[model samples]
Target: MSDDVTAAADAVRHGEVVVYPTETVYGMGADATNPDAVERVFDTKGRDRDKPLSAGFPSVDAALEYVVTTDLEVAFMRRFLPGPVTVVVERRDALPDVLVAGRDRVGVRVPDHDLACDFFERADTPVTATSANRSGTGSITNPSQLSDDVREAVAVVLDGGTTPGTESTVVDPGRGIIHRRGAMADDIETWLAEHADSEPDA
Candidate 1:
């Protein structure tokens, strides 16, 4: 692992927030199981406490350790994960309520970025997967674009050049709902419709 990844993982383990690159955009990450660390992510971004953050993992199998997924949800994850998509699924108790805003389900992100995956694996814990920007501001594509407040709040910043900048498509496969129409909306919609009958009633 790179020195930066090791340091970032250590910071996360110590309940500090960090900024890292993702396939879609730059993301603010913290240990998802730590309520205080997760709250720091929201505070740093000026995000509403009511809004939930996604749990990031290195792979679908890694995510399975912290979320409860049905066969359909697992299929959906295998199809679109490691891409620009956030799959909403039931959260395991290990994931603190603060990360999900007291909701039963949480968004799961497996970013298709080498640096991000490496960080998650090295961290050996789920990290908050929200954009690295203040709430209501444009998502960050580069570390240079990060605001002073965000940059100062984070303990580490992993600059992976520039990212795609588009946000991930947030989908609830079990409920057949596409909360945010982003990256691959049409394809996700098509998949949802095709497997509508197979999904458990929401």
Candidate 2:
């Protein structure tokens, strides 16, 4: 691993936040299971406490450790994960309530970026997967665009050049709902419609 990636991972394990690149955009990361670390993310971004943050893992299999997934959800993950998509599913007790905002469900992200996955794997835990920007502000595509507040709040910044800058599509496959339409919306919608019959009754 590169020195920057290793530092970022170490910061996360030490309950500090870091900024890292993702396939969609730059993301603010902290140990998702740590309530204090998660609170720091919300505070740093001035984000509403009720607004839940997604947890990022190195892979779908790693994410499965923190979320409860049905067969349909598993199929959906297999089809679109390691891409720009946030799959919402039930959270395991291992996740802090702060991360999910006291909600039963949480968003799971497996970014299709080598740096991100490497950081997650080295961190050895799920990390907060929210954009690396203050709430209500634009998402960041490059480390150069990161605000002073965000930069100062984070312990490390892993610059992986520029990112695609699009937000990931957020969907609840079990409920067959698309909470937010973003990258690959059309393809995701098509997949959902074609697999609607397989979704568990809501």
Best by lDDT: 2
Estimate, for each residue in 152-183, the C-alpha lDDT of model 2 and write its tens digit: 99999998999988899999999999999999
Cα RMSD of predicted structure 2? 0.9
**What are the per-model C-alpha RMSD values against the true structure?**
1.0, 0.9
Question: How far out, in Å, is residue 50 in model 1?
Answer: 0.5
lDDT of 1 by residue, 1-202 (tens): 3999999999999999999999899999999999999999999999999999999999999999998889999999999989999999999999988888899999999999999999999999999999999999999998999999998899999989999888899999999999999999999999999999985665
CA error at residue 74 for candidate 2, angstroms: 0.3
Give residue 35's lDDT in candidate 1 (0 to 100). 94
lDDT of 1: 0.94
TM-score per model over all chains: 0.97, 0.98
